[model samples]
Each structure stands twice: as C-alpha cells, then as structure tokens.
Target: MASLELRNVNKRYGQGQADTLKNINLSIDSGEFLILVGPSGCGKSTLMNCIAGLENISGGEILVEDQPISGMSPKDRDIAMVFQSYALYPTMSVRDNIAFGLKMRKVPQARIDEEVERVAKLLQIEHLLHRKPSQLSGGQQQRVAMGRALARRPKIYLFDEPLSNLDAKLRVEMRTEIKLMHQRLKTTTVYVTHDQIEAMTLGDKVAVMKDGIIQQFATPQEIYNSPANLFVASFIGSPPMNFIPLRLQRQGARWVAVLDSGQDRYELPLSVEDGQSLEGREVILGIRPEQITAANEGGPALRAEVQVVEPTGPDTLVFVSLNEVKVCCRLAPDAAPRAGESLALQFDPDRVLLFDANTGERLSKAPEHIPAGQSGNIAQFAAR
Candidate 1:
C-alpha cells in the first residue's frame, strides 16, 4: 500500500487546444480507496493515465509516499491498472494471462502459482483458469484482468470503469466482490466511473471531475448533500437535484422565493445570508426530491399542480412545475397523489440550497458543514 499525491497537475494535448487536466490537486492515504467520476471527455481517464505513467503530465508533480514519480516509466511506478478493455492476450489461457505480469517481474515459479491461485479464488475465476481469453465470457475476462493486477502486490491499483462492460446483475455482484476484496487487502486504489451509484457506494473518497478539473473531492455523502456548486449538486444525485429558478423578494424581514404554479404563488423562506445578497435579485433554489414530503405532518407548505407520478418500486416520484422548471418530489409509495391533482409539499429550509442561476455557483457563503465521515479524510492529501 502507498499514499499518492497530485499537486497542481496540468495536462494539455497541444498548445492551441484546451488543457485536459487543470491545476489538479488531490491525495489519498495508503489503503484508502479514491474514486474519480465525471462525464466523458472531462479528462478523468487522462488523469488516471498520468498517475500510471501511461501519459505524462505537462506541469506539476505526482508523488507516491512523498517520492516524486513524475518522470518514472509505467513499469517503474509500482502500480497496477485494470483497463475498461480486458486487454488479455487472445492466445493465452486465463491462468497464463494472469501469470504473465509476475513472470516478467521474475517472481519464483512457486510464488507465481500461489499468487495466481490467490487472486483467482478471490475473483472467483479459479474454474476458468485453463480457458483461453476467446473461450471466456466478458465478465470472466474482466475477472482475469483483475486477477492479473491482484497477482502483484503493487503500491497502488487503478481501475478505470472495469465493470462498465458487464450486465447490470453481474456488475452489482462484482461491485460487492470488489468491496469485499478491498476490505481484505486494504490496498490503496483509484477508480474512475461515470455511474453515480458506484461513486456513492464505493470509495473512501470521491472526486467529482468535469472539464478536466476536480470540482469537488469529498466523501459520498458530502458530494450528495453539500455539493460545492450547482454542477456538483446536479451531477452526484439520481433524478438530479431540483433546480427552481425564481426571483427572491423580501416578505417582512425574511427573504422568500416566490413559487408560481400558474394559479397561486407560495413563498419559501431563504437563508438570512442568502436573502441579504438577493434583496430583489433572481437565484435558483436547489432541493433534492427526497427533501420534499407531504405537508400533512406540518411544515412550510407550497401547493403545486402534479404533472406526473412515476413509481420506482421503492418510492414514487411526483413531478410538478415551479417557475417553468420541472421539480421532482420523492414521496412515499402509498402517499402518491394522482396527476393533475394539487398537493402541498413541505420543504426543510435548512436543506434548501441556493445557487446563482447565471454562474451556477452557490450563492450562500455559508461554509459547508460536512457531516462526520462525509470526506473520509480526502483533505489529508494536502497534508501529504
């Protein structure tokens, strides 16, 4: 296991082109798992290649255990990487493919056999060892790729969407297995994926990347609950955060967001600090669907015309329009009302997020109060 650090890392494909990665900074402790997530072309994969020495950085440094490794070759980095493509030798048997890495490193024949057996069993691919890559299924081939990486005790392991090719059911099974293996091995790892569920469930720390930049690096909960900006807030959540754009007006001393559903207007209280900045200005009110609930229990209520109701097995998603933007409310399955019906929704003021609609930045200056375990020590990168 090893600690990894990236300081002001920057990558550019060419002088006239946009930089693939910009002023990137992150660190992870030994035995910790860090996930990198972003849309395609956002440079998440490029950042991974940089760390593995598959691609060189244009500026800054990458350090492993406080030793500079920016100039190291891929083989000298003491890291193992599993690519989205399995990259198995077509003619090699699964066992040979897994043993190839160890053989090149000149591991003793007995040790290589033992190591191959260890990873095969861990990945549950022991039965398919003698099969050629062409004879194995995609999922099995992925396991062989994982076995090849796990065969060596590298300082770090890098997984770039290794399960993206698997079916949903197999992907979930492999996810659980990966978690179990990580718990047992305690190897420092960096994973990149576009799946929100993977970003939330795996990883000790999650870095939400976009346009080649690390937007937010924190625990899964922080990225979900207290996103630093509108983009981070929308990207990390399923069904996405509800963005209701409206002008803020002062009602008595409190600032209120006027919500209109074509018939009536209801006001929702805004933070005092946020209210101060937007005396008569416009801003977006961001709330998660789960934050909105039935008002029968008593809270600030705003009546909206329900446009649609979608039942997602576990919960019912109610769609409504507020100031021309569609807002979703996650309601209990049994509490769902019919479409075209008006239902009063209760919102928690403290849970409401206010963002500058034009800039897509959080308007409230309040320091994000990340709940404990929210970051999982991702900030420790700065210390290293």
Candidate 2:
C-alpha cells in the first residue's frame, strides 16, 4: 500500500474558462480510507478521474509514496478502480473476470487460480465463481467487480459510488461487507459518493467538497460536530443543522441570543466574549435537531407550540417555531406531543454554535460564561 497526495492540483477544461478544481491539496496515509463527497456537478467525479489518470490534471502533482505519478498512465499507476456500473463483462464467469488482470500481466495460470479463490472467499462469493455476470444479481456483480480489483493487490483502490445502483437493503449489507473487507485488507482507498451516510461511515477521513474545492477534510466525528462552514454543516448531517436568525446582545461580559416564541422571549447565553462588536449584528444560531429536546426541570427551556410531529420509528421529530424560523427537535417517540400542544424545549448551550449571517463562517471561540442561578458547566434559563 502507498500513501496518496494531491498538491496544488488544478483542472481546467479550456484556456479561457474557469478552473474546475482550484489548488486542491490533500494527503492520506497508507491504508487509510478517504471519502470524497459533495452534491452533483461538484467535480467529485472529475477529481476521481484525475487521480485514476483517466483525465489528466492541468497542473500540480499527484504522488504515491512521495513519488510523482501525475505523468504516469493509469495502467502503470498500480491502482485499481471499481465503477458504479459494476462494469463486469457479460460473457465472462466470475472466476475468469477476477483472473483477467492477472492474465494480462502474464501471471501463471496456477497462481491466477489461487488468487481468484482467495478473492472469492474474501468477498464470500466462492459459490458464484462459475456464474456469468448476466446470471448474477446487482450485488453479486458488484462483488465480482471488487474481486477483480482485490485479485490485483494494487497499491490503491478507487471506488466511485459502487453501491448506488443496489437496492436499499442490499446497499446497507454491501456497505458493511465493504467496511469489513477494508479492515481485513487494509488497502489504501479513495471513494467518491454523494451519500452522506456512506461518506461518514466508510471513510477513515472525509473530504467534503463543493464547487471543486474541499470545504473540510477531517474525521467523521469532527466533520459532524465541528464543521468549518455553514455549507459543510448543512451538507453532512441527516436532518441537517437548524439555523435560527437572531441578533447578538451584550449581557455583561458575555453575549446572549434572544429567541421570541411570539409570547415570551428567552435569553440564550453564548460563550463568545466580544459581544459589544456583534451587538445589533445579525447571526445564525446552529444546533442539531438531536441537540434540542423536551425541557427538563432546572435547565434552559423555550416555550413553543408544537407545529408538527413525525415518528420515524427510532426517534420522533417535532417541529416548532422560534424567532419566526421553523425548527426541528429530535425527541423520544413517547415524549412528542400533538400539534397545537405547548411544549417547553431545552438546548445544550455548551453545544450550541454561532455563525456569521453574512459570510456563513463560524465565529471565533471565546470563553464561556455560566448564567445566573446555573452551575459553571451548565446554563439554565427557561421561557414560558
């Protein structure tokens, strides 16, 4: 396995047109699973194609194990790629398909047979070795495609949305199988997917891309908990983070956010200290749905009428309005109340995030201040 690096990479279609990728820089250690994820037309596939040498980069270097490989052909890069379409030959049996690359390399027939058996067992497709691609299911065909790459034992593997074509159930199963296989093989991999779940779960490190530039490159937990920008925060979560438009107010040494529920106003303490500069400045308050919950005694709460309730089996999503902005709160199914019922909602102030409304950038860190009548670690304020 080899560490992969992209340095100052830039791609442009024509002389006068804008660049597709701009000064992209990323690196992954050997045996790391790196996921590139973004919306459609975001240049994710183009980046993958460049790394595979299918599309030549207009500038910068692509390196493997610290050796430049930008000028090398795809066939000479010691990399294997699996496409979303499975790309299996209809006439070839699974065994033959897996052995085709070895054959092209003039490996011995005996060695090819051994390699095919090993990959089939690794993929749990030993029983389907003799079946032609036309005779197998989509999931099986995908495994065969993966087996073809695994048989080669290449330095790096590129998977471009390999599970997108499968049904939901099969996709989930295949995801687990792929993770297990990666754990066992420990191959250096770069995967491209539009699915946030796949990006978060499969990658040891994730690169959230947009407009051909990497927005943030970090571990799944960091990307989810501490996003670098509003775009990254909105793109990576399931229900996505809730954005409430509010203005900052100076409350002594620290800042506070005022939330009005049409009847009462609640002062939500903020950790930021430079509130004097931000007073009267519009900002966005970001908190995940899971971070908001039914109010508990002796803690901060917001009084609002339930607008809607959706039970998703695992959890209940309750909708409420604060500061005229519709907000979603994740709660236990039993805790959710009917629409029109007034509820008191609590927030984890320590977990709350603030963003600049104009630029969508996160605010700089400041020391947290505990509200009156609350412990140093917890801020307690309620609205009714």
Candidate 3:
C-alpha cells in the first residue's frame, strides 16, 4: 500500500472560467479508507478521473508515496479503479476478465490462475468463473469488475459508487462485504458516493465537497458531531439537521431565543458567555431531530402542534412548526403523538447551536447565563 496526496489539484474542462476541481488538497495515509461525498454535479467523478490518471489535472500535482505521478500513465500508476458502470470485456469469461491485468503484466500462467481463483472465492464468484459477462446479472458483473481489480495487489484502490446500481437490500449486503474486505486487506482506498448513509458507514475519513471545493475532511464521528460550518452540518446527516430562525434579545443580563410555535411562546435561555456576543440580533438556531425528545424527568419542555408523525420502524419522527420554520423531533416509537395533537417536546439547551442567519456561520462565543449542562435562559450550543 502507498499514501496518496493531491496538492492544490485543479481541473478545468475549458477556458470558460469554471473549474471542475478547484485547488483541491488532500492526503490519504497508506491503508486508509477515504470517502468523497457530495450532491450530483459537484465534480466528484471529475476528481476521481483525475486521480486515476484518466483526466490530466490542469494544475497541481498528484503524488504516490511522496513521488510525483501527475505525468505518469494510468498503466504505470499502479492503481486499480472500479467504476459505477461495470466496464467488463463482453468476450471474456469471468476468470479471463479477472486475469486480464496479470496477462498484460506477463505473469506466469500458473500464478495468474492462482490469483484469479483466489479473488473469485473472495468475491463469491468462484461458481461463475467459466461464465461470460453476458450471462451474469448486474451485481455479478459488478463483482467481476471488482475481481478484475482485486486480482492484482496495487498501490491503491478507487471505487466510484460501485454498489449504486444494486437494489437496496443488495446494496446493504455489499456495503458490509466491502467493509470486511477492506479490514482484511488493509489497502489504501478512496471511494465516491452520493448516499449519506454510505458516506457515514463506509469511510474511515470523509471529505464533504460542493461546487468543486471540499467543505470538511474528518473522521465520520467528528464530521457528524463537530461540523466546521453550516454546509457540513446539513450535508452529512440523515433527514438533515434542522435550522430555525429566531430573534435574539437581551433579557436582563442574558440573551434569550424567543421561540413561538404559533401555539405557545417560550424563552429558551442561553449561556451568558454565548449570549454576550448577541445582545439584540436575529440568528439561526440549529438542532438535530434526535436532540429533541419526549418529556423526561426534569427536562425543559415546549408545547407545539404536531403537523405529522412518521414511524420508520426503528424510531418515530415528528414534524412541527417552530417560529414559522418546520422543525423535526425524533422520539421513541411508543411515545409518538398523533397529527393535529399538541405535544410537549423536551430539548437539552446545551445541544442547541446558534448561527448567523445571513451567512449561516456558527457563533464561537457561548452564553454565560446558561449552565454547562442544561439551560433555562437561552439555548446554547447545538450538538452536531
């Protein structure tokens, strides 16, 4: 395995002034699994192509183990890529397809056979070894494509949505298989996907991208817990994080967020430290659905009219209006209230986040009135 580095990498299709990859910089340790995640049209595939040596970077360098390989041909880069489309050779059998790379490298016949057999078993395609690509299903074809790459122990592996075409159930199974395979091989890899769940579950490190720029790069836990900015907060979570616009006003020696659900009005306290910076201003209050819960002993509760309740088997999601913005609350399935019913929602003030309404940037200063653990003044930090 080898470490991969991209220093200020850039790629532009034409002189139209728009860059597909803009001054991208990242470093992947040897044997690390990194995931690239973003919305469609965000230039993820273009970046992957550049790394594969298929699309030459307009500027900057690509390095493998501290050696510059930007000018190297794909054949000399010693990297294997499995694309979304299973670009298999239709004329070759599964065994031959897996052996093609070894054949090109002129490996001894016996060794090629041994390598193909090993990958076939690893990929669970040993039974289909003699069948041609034309006879296999889409999933089978994709496995063959993987086998073709895995048959050789390359410096790194690149997978571009390799499980995207499979059905939901199959996708989950393959995802587990891929993780297990990575753990066993300890190979350096970079994978791209649009699925948030896949991004959270598969990657040891994730880079959230948008408009050709990386928003944040960190471990899955850090990305989910301490997002650098609003974009990172909204992009990495399932059902997404909730943003509620509120008016911040100084009440006594503290600043409080006045929340009106059209049914009830409540002042959620903020720490004097956090509220000190926003004496009288409007800001966006961010929170996750899971942070809001049904009433527990000694918890702060706010009343709201439930607009809808969705039970997703594992848990229940309740949607309601807060200060004219739709806010979600995740509750235990048994505790969910029906639509049109008024429910008292509980929130831990320390878990609330404050952001600039216009710029959507997080506020660094916390309020002082609110205690370290809970709040009765103004809601303070929003746990990612």
Candidate 1: residue pairs that collide: none
Task: Return the number of clashes found in candidate 2.
Answer: 0
User: Candidate 1 — which residues are off by over 4 angstroms?
Assistant: 274-276, 297-299, 365-384
Every model: Cα RMSD to truth:
3.3, 6.6, 5.2
The sequence of per-residue lDDT tens digits that candidate 1 reaches over residues 67-148 is 9999999999989999999899999999999999899999999999999999888888989999999998888988899899
In model 3, the runs with Cα more than 4 Å from the true position are 251-254, 271-276, 365-384
lDDT of 2 by residue, 61-120 (tens): 999999999999998998999999989978888988999989988999999999999999
Query: What TM-score does prediction 1 earn?
Result: 0.93
Candidate 1 vs candidate 3: the TM-score winner is 1
lDDT string for model 3 (71-117, tens) is 99999899999989888889999888899999999999999999998
Best-fitting candidate, scored by lDDT: 2
- Indicate the residue-level lDDT of 235 in model 1: 91
Reference-based lDDT, each prediction? 0.86, 0.87, 0.84
